[model samples]
Target: MFLQNNEIRDLLNQVADLLEIRDDNPFRVRAYREAARVIEQMTEPVASLVKANKDLSQYRGIGRDLAAKIREIVETGGLEQLRRLRQELPVSLLDLMQVPSLGPKKTAQLYKHLGVASLEDLERAARRGQIADLSGFGEKSQQHIIESLGRVKKSGEKRLLWSDAAVHARALEEYLMDIEGVRRVRVAGSFRRGEETVGDLDVLVTCGRDREKDVMEAFVSFEGVKNILSHGKTKSSVILRPGLQVDLRIVAQVSYGAALHYFTGSRAHNIAVRKLAQDKGYKINEYGVYQGEKRVAGKTEKEVYASVGLTYIPPELRENMGEIQAAADNRLPALLKRSDIRGDLHCHTRRTDGHGSLEEMAHGAIAMGYQYLAVTEHSQKVAMAGGLNEKQVLQYMKKIDAINEKFSGFRLLKGMEVDILADGRLDLADSVLAQLDLVVCSVHYQQRMDEKKQTERIIRAMDNPYCHILGHPTARLINTRDPMEIDLEKIILAAKDRGVILELNAQPDRLDLPSSYCKMAAESGVRIAVSTDAHSVENLELMENGIAAARRGWLTRNDVVNTRSLSELLRLLRRP
Candidate 1:
């Protein structure tokens, strides 16, 4: 199998985690972790680069040694080093480390002292009060472990994040398009709907009748296929490495649109549309819309919608959430697009945990045609990210001024992603915050407060006059960490009242301010800032994902604060 960059990145990260568990040299572990990050953020596939004989060492964290390792994985589809590491470590330790609060050290301790080798064993130990007797794990830790085990058990089949899924989807699409007689190919289902996570891929294709068998054969024989679940002349299902299932279906050209519609569905949306078709005395199926056995509309999605007395609806809005009514009323929003974004409000630099320098980041924004960019580095509260102290922030402001002076048309706004302390205090003083162009307040710690306290903490933070935006409002990492306990409605109402722009953080894992909440905030007259929260120059591209999320929420260009020009955005921000 041709290894995708993500697969290699995952293998490298697993190697690093295992190394940490084995108490290897910290720098060696960091080397693997950094290489993984470099691969993860690369816009180009490492395999292609390797095929072209490009110098991988030019990448941020990849040195000559790491470059060789990457090539080995790309060419061979496996890393002998990682395989050996796996052989040495208990494989279950990896799963155990995924539990919240269970770091590599703790995992190692559990393995060494208590012989806790797997989640099941750990659960048993915790239930029997054996975990509490361990060297570092007390009764409270045991309870926390038990709670986390329940969460892990509940989080069933892993779903790929949209960004991760896009890589695989595009690769498969390209792979299938190369077949001789394939007419059209589309990836349907929640992925097509731009959902945050997708359970599997539904690939729909149109091909000549004679080519159907050939297409199915080619699909199941693809390089990435791990196992064939089922095979047929027109339909085939296969499981890829890492356990993502893909189902491929071949349809006639005439039934392509109908099949696409049927496959690209939220069950509710499909049911509603089918009922509408039935009410109009037409039978709709994956093949076509039939009027008493005579084919009517099926060749195109537009015709399918036209048959139902409605204009075509974009796939992102196909959640059956009043979209049909909105379509009938001609009230479907002109959703925000990537080109509509004029600036980025939340980004980081090397002064914090970010990899890029201020100049590199500014150049990246300029390349994207952004009129302005905000350098919102972490505040002192997040010291692990090398957050700046008061003096450091002032000095950084001087540096930004220098850079701003260097550029004629572009502007760099001095901003800080300040921490909202547990007691509802800003990490930086008002005097310090008042000096900046903007402040993006967020909760970095104390995420487990009771609902009232968490809500109140956020509300108080929003109430601060200098707080212009709320960064990653819920602090949820998709499929991993659950959103903190808080009344989001109360927080949204407070943001509306305070004129605090809610952020749709564009980082793939932290696509916070989910589509549904974005809709609520939009309806409440709260504007959203779809900022990348970018840590590197490459990460600025994540804005597209943010725009996708906004479109899914039915937000228009006017609903996004950064879609406005500099002066207009500043005016919005300055409103007290």
Candidate 2:
């Protein structure tokens, strides 16, 4: 198993806690804590160095004794001191430490006296009139734990984006790679697509017999592990670092493809595949697909799909989005590649409320290989948000011209996130809007308007020659707010006739226009613009989410506006 600085650090945190509770050596505890800090930031995977028998003593803050212990942890599943501490203190006592608000000291105090184990039991004891009687855990401390548990429960089901998952997955990969005889390992599912919210984590690994048990032990003992959700020979789940649940599954070399296919999913897609397998007189599971007489699909995913007379689906398109039909019919749309995007049309900067300066924003876009960037700051109506008033808008335009002047490559278009007022009028003056390179009209206020009013506002905005794109048309945040009611058909038709593009806002929280509407937008001859209504440098990465959402609508690159080059975009903008 390979251990990363973070994984080692996490393990040290647990060890440090156990030592403190056992009243063990203070310097030893400090050593573990310091070691963890050094390991957490170590760029290279630790297991590789261990396999090569490299000198770990060179690692900063790693002394002779600590390096030996790290070697012991890498080789054996457990350390002698850590095992002794565990024997002295119940493993269940770690549950108290798992609560968000409880620190190691508070956890030790609770365990030393009250004999609390799990959070549920602690809550019961606290509420049943026993906590106040304890020495350090007065009403305030008790209340804090209860509140923390409640908050944890409420926020539990939320998913993490792929970007966040990579951090955790890389840590686990490093820890597991250190184990002997383990081969390739990779992360699959929504994390691969870079989706913002991840439901469960799936890691695929290949290993030999001796390594499996050792790997499982090390995996279960991972510093981030809060609870052993479940463990088995082929698979195991552990709640690591808060409510984030990670599930790891191991496979023999042959079954790797089958296992990955089974895990990477939209449940609907899997079910469809299973039905196909049934028709072909075979059974498919995480292990391998079997015919009544023999095993067929265990070695590779392509083989698994080929058994069903279909092409293997790409991970991004494994959402049952007519993939099965396309596979059977051999008509799957070639999904858009990252390189298809020519420019980023809707972005924010410090000239408005964005975190980075205009130059920084453009440089970031350029760094992402964008040929052009539309610097669309907020219009004057949103005054509270440092919106660009008339003078500020002109001054910013001049600044943008200066920026374009200094920069040799890539065009920066002057634009604004103009508001669609309650009266179905754009907030910016027509003459003022005409002076800009592009305009994106969106709804900021009046989200509560009736469907007729909202539809009319959107339609009226689309009719304007200056309005290049209708940003996040319905103003809905997935799983949070209901899409504002609108006559989408009528509005889409208007946009089509007016040659206006409807934006699929790439912000994770607001993948607006919904996938269904985007399909309709595409059919209406109204091009769709997948733009990251980015407020910061980091926000530009939200384009993946936009692409994912667009995929759900069966969008092709040609149907998207931003896929057009600057000349093409200008040509479309010049349409009557």
Candidate 3:
């Protein structure tokens, strides 16, 4: 009955979205949104805090009332205020906001003007030319919406970020393991593969064959189960409350590894492995590796791979992208591990849009066992974030200097996430940028520029000696907006030439530098900083997501710049 962190965040976000749709107090709505953000970044479960009778109000953005509401959710498994809000207004209206580039304002417009309560309704209106006539949405905007709708519809199946899906999958695995009859439970499928997004989860459980029904019953009765899709003696499927599908299978321990390998597949990888098995006069399947009906090897994934004369491939590398050949050749990379990261290069504090104070962020970094952290707040170009101007930047640097004095071992490096202006110049002047320890230049606007121009713009920014890293290189938001057409090859090469680092931003929604591109950068010998770009103390925990991405991209400890000692990293950041 424990609520996963993601569930709490989703519920809180629902409240925020409902409040926004209802046009409630802006501050109140912001509080909820901020609270959701904080909860999502938390490494520890809020439910655990609730169970311990901890003071939740101490967390940023959670006041006394929000604390009580959170407590009620943990105890009752639902929020009464959210229930009342949904009763006042149908929740479907918020789905339209999922369309790329459509904000709450536009969503409300569609709802108010065209009675568009769902994606279907909105599409019908747009195709009928009704949306074009709305006050704010003209023909051009309508065309854009229509195009975006196609993107939304084409996306199909509504996948959640791997990290988000992990929250549910891991929770369910643990919950199932607690069942008396359950001998073992492992979350398979894309979650195990470390795919950036997961559409569904396949959970394999090994329990007494005679107790299958008992396990099936418990699976369907999970607290997060929103709907039972099926119930059976050996297998059952349920859709979790957050719309993630989970399929539970009762497996025999003897075939557990084979089942895990079969279920945790990139279909092509499994097919290739099966082909290899066939060449060896054997069959590989979920049941077990068979040689003319007699089981051969399948007790472990390593056995399965070895039976085919191949070494075991890490789950992250099983994308059928030459991994089989690499495994056979014993050339697979020793992937990056979480422990290799020494510090985060991109960070923010109260000086910008971040929720944490400077000292708070530093302490959090220290708690993470980091040797250093870059306090890279936004520059003046990002006005909405309370971006710092030149004078403030000077004061901010001075503040960082003073803060650094208090810490004996850990260091707070002064820096800015300087906006890469549309024409390629940095938001901060060279003089101001020169005074900082590092600069992470990023594009906050003009994301629609043609591929060539975007590539040129980013390369030009790298030409600036102070620009040490390119933050979120593609400026992509997963499932929301497409990556800008920057030629990553060109950017990677430019970064190498300019001694600039590329960032693998660990934000769940923006795991920028997708694994494919991360591989490209690695092959080109460009170093990466797997920074979380943390905005809160909790956000620092997101570094794991970046590590996961790095592993999937075939990066090693040497491929990441942050794995170096503080002195080495400082030397690397110092561009020639």
> Clashes per prediction?
0, 15, 0
lDDT of 3: 0.88
Question: Which candidate number would show the highest lDDT if scored against the true structure?
Answer: 1
Q: Distance (Å) between predicted and true CA of 549, model 2?
A: 2.7
- Please give the TM-score that candidate 2 achieves against the real structure: 0.70
Query: Candidate 1 vs candidate 3: which has greater TM-score?
Result: 1
Task: Give the TM-scores of the predictions, in the order they appear.
Answer: 0.94, 0.70, 0.93
What is candidate 2's lDDT per residue for 1-576, written digit by digit as tens? 444344555566779888877667888887787676556435465666777898988864679888888778777645787788778888766656545546566667777677776677778877876777777667765765676567656755655544345668777888788778889787777765444467767888899876787777888999768789888876888997535688887888888888888878767888999999999899998778899857787788898899888987777677776779988998877766677988888998766666568887888898888888999998878886678777788888898999898776689988989988888788878888989999999998867567888888788777777888888888876433457778888888888888888898877667776777887888677789899987666567768778877876778998887889888888877758
lDDT of 3 by residue, 193-312 (tens): 888899999999999877788889889999889899999888899999878999999888899889989999989999999999888899999989999989988888898999998898
CA displacement after TM-score superposition, residue 514 of candidate 1 (Å): 1.5
Ranking by TM-score: 1, 3, 2
Candidate 3 runs further than 4 Å off: 51-53, 84-90, 129-141, 181-183, 208-214
Candidate that would win on TM-score = 1
The C-alpha RMSD of each candidate to the native structure, in angstroms, is: 2.2, 11.3, 2.4
Worst 10 residues of 1 by lDDT: 476-485
